[model samples]
Target: MAGRVAAVDCGTNSIRLLIADLVDGRLVEVDRRMTIVRLGQGVDASGAFAPEALERVFAAASDFAAVIRAAGVGRMRFVATSAARDVSNREVFRNGIEERVGIRPEIISGEEEAELSFRGATTSLDLPAPYLVTDIGGGSTELVLGDAGGVIAAESLDIGSVRLTERHVTTDPTSAVELAAITRDIDVLLDKTRVPLDEARAVVAVAGTATTVAAVALNLPEYDRDAVHRARLTADQLRDTTTWLTTSTRAARAAVHSIHPGRVDVIGAGALILQRLVDRLSVDSVLVSEHDILDGVALSLG
Candidate 1:
């Protein structure tokens, strides 16, 4: 069945939309875009969606709705993760999206989130099986161990860039105490993760955090999706980049052409999470994927 479909991934830090044509059991991209709304802003401490945050997300939803309509998408799925699951005022966020997009957003579980990430990331990769897929989002990080057949074990941890930054970051360049606090939290979550990291034959990292890191690693004068996507980055490269990001001032990070302004404040935390995972897995290199849960949701529409 050939059809035009759209998938909207409203995560903690950004809202992304993907409109694609489903033909012969594969997705052909029609449009793909992202907007940094920081929907999870203050949700960790406040335990509810902030009024300003809801407004930003609603505005993005309106824009995405227009795009979907323009593309004439026949089917669309909106999935909300992390912050949506933690917030008490979810109805406000949900009703706002439904009003603009004409479809209710599904607040998916962490396990399901991991599965979708794995599917979207591995579908186009010609890599070794038993691959470990990691999605470092704003509110949470999902670790999924799977192969060509399917997923084996997966876990979604609460340690994310926005969450960690909100909890333990105050200095300009981030003090040693702040970094240690963040690292400790990440280590604690990774320690409890049940997804056998040792079983992975290859590692594939997905979403904004991984791709942005890849862009810096490649030393791109600007953000280039083609160069970042599917690019292999060694462990040493990741470590050095992480070190530089965590130690650099906000002005220096903002000056980088590869780092998005929305991510400039928290990329260090995101990079640290990636670096810690790489060290834990002891992998020589990791393959970065631009296609992620958005692709997974689009595929599910078929």
Candidate 2:
């Protein structure tokens, strides 16, 4: 049976809504958009959602609710990751969402987040099997290893764009010390990753960080999903882009139309995280995908 469904993914830095018609196990997109709410703002240090952050997220949720109603969505799922898991006042956040959206958001585990991200990134691609899918989000990064049969292994780490930047990046253009600290943190998490990186024949990276990097690498005048999706970049290209992003001033990075304004302060750390992952992979290049956990969540509703 075909049905219209909606999935809302509220992460540390942003919240996104995806509405699609599920027909024969495929998603016909209806509406997909994201807002930078920074829901996890100050969460790493405070262990709770900031008042302003909660306000922003609630506003986004209300708007999303309106869209869902207009789309006539039959089923909807809301999932919150990373910061939601760490926050002390989760019930406040949950109740507010349920009030506006008519359903509580699930604070999913890292493993589950990894699985959803893997499903979304691999579902539409015809790439080689035994793929390593990496999703670098705002508060955490998910790495999943799997083939056609399904996920072989997955792990989610605490290293993310906003989290790392909030912790390490205090200087403009990222001082060498700050960059080194960010690198060390990312390497430490990568060291603990359970997925066998060497087993992957293809590497597909999803979510905003990877997509933004791909856009910049392609030199698109603006953020073009058509051009960024499925774009492949070699290790050298990734390294160069990563270097530029990390060394460039916030003003310079914001000037790049492809880099989101919300991500300007944290993208350097995000790029560094992607660069380290690329360095670890045996493959010469990585494929970037715009489809991620939100798509997986929609598929699950069906």
Candidate 3:
């Protein structure tokens, strides 16, 4: 209860674990883990968890729990986001987690997920008041508006990297026709999120897509928390990157200088969503934050 805290965010696309020790009010990370399990791979169409997907997620959870235990984490909590919230077999997965990993994950609402994302992005920021936060994840994109260090309004849209890719980009190369449909769909989601966009001073982007774009912008070969945690991207950069990703095949995208190899497949839809949001909102720049729900969960415990 007094040494360290661990939080795992089990998402549709990835499983992320953060274990940190709080010393003099500062959190020092003891262990961090990320695995792409794609638990909700085809849930958009099938409306049920695929067998492989379920197995992968459960295995990831089992590994994460072992890591936390090995690290001797003092306190911990696990939460599942959009994917778990939307799935009908959520209880089955939750029950399985308890049996397999000795941990029962809490399925958080979209609004709650957005709020946690907001906390992770801005809690450490020295930004101007009234910031906008958005986390474009696997199955949902969370948008939030807040003043200073606290959230004011937040909402989660059903558009995410996996969902968009599965729903629109059916072709191996994602033909222009498919790309156009994804663009149009993302434009609509942006329209709905504009309510929060209009109220904030600057946009703070978190989660995989946002951070992956920032990683690309910095031209880093691998993820660098220090380099990307507060990396900034302009409107032009966002638009250009979106265009570049949409034009390249998955292999070609993987060969890019900074893009992560695992992220290549879904980056196209993710970038387009980010680009449309920035363009439609007329925002000049966006800052990317690597800390997301895990960071929020760790801090809230104190």
Which 10 consecutive residues of model 3 have the lowest summed lDDT?
A: 192-201
lDDT of 2 by residue, 193-258 (tens): 788888888999999999999999999999999999889999999999999999999899989999
lDDT for position 301 in model 3:
65
Pairs of residues at least 3 apart in sequence or in different chains that clash in candidate 1: none
lDDT at position 37, candidate 1: 97
Q: For candidate 1, lDDT tens digit of each residue in 1-302?
A: 79999999999999999999999879999999999999999999999999999999999999999989999899989999999999999999999999999999999999999999989988967778788999999999999998888899999999899999999999999999999999999999898888888877889999999999999989999999999989999999999999999999999999999999999999999999999998987579999999899999999998
True-structure RMSD, every candidate: 0.7, 0.8, 1.7
TM-score of each prediction: 0.99, 0.99, 0.94
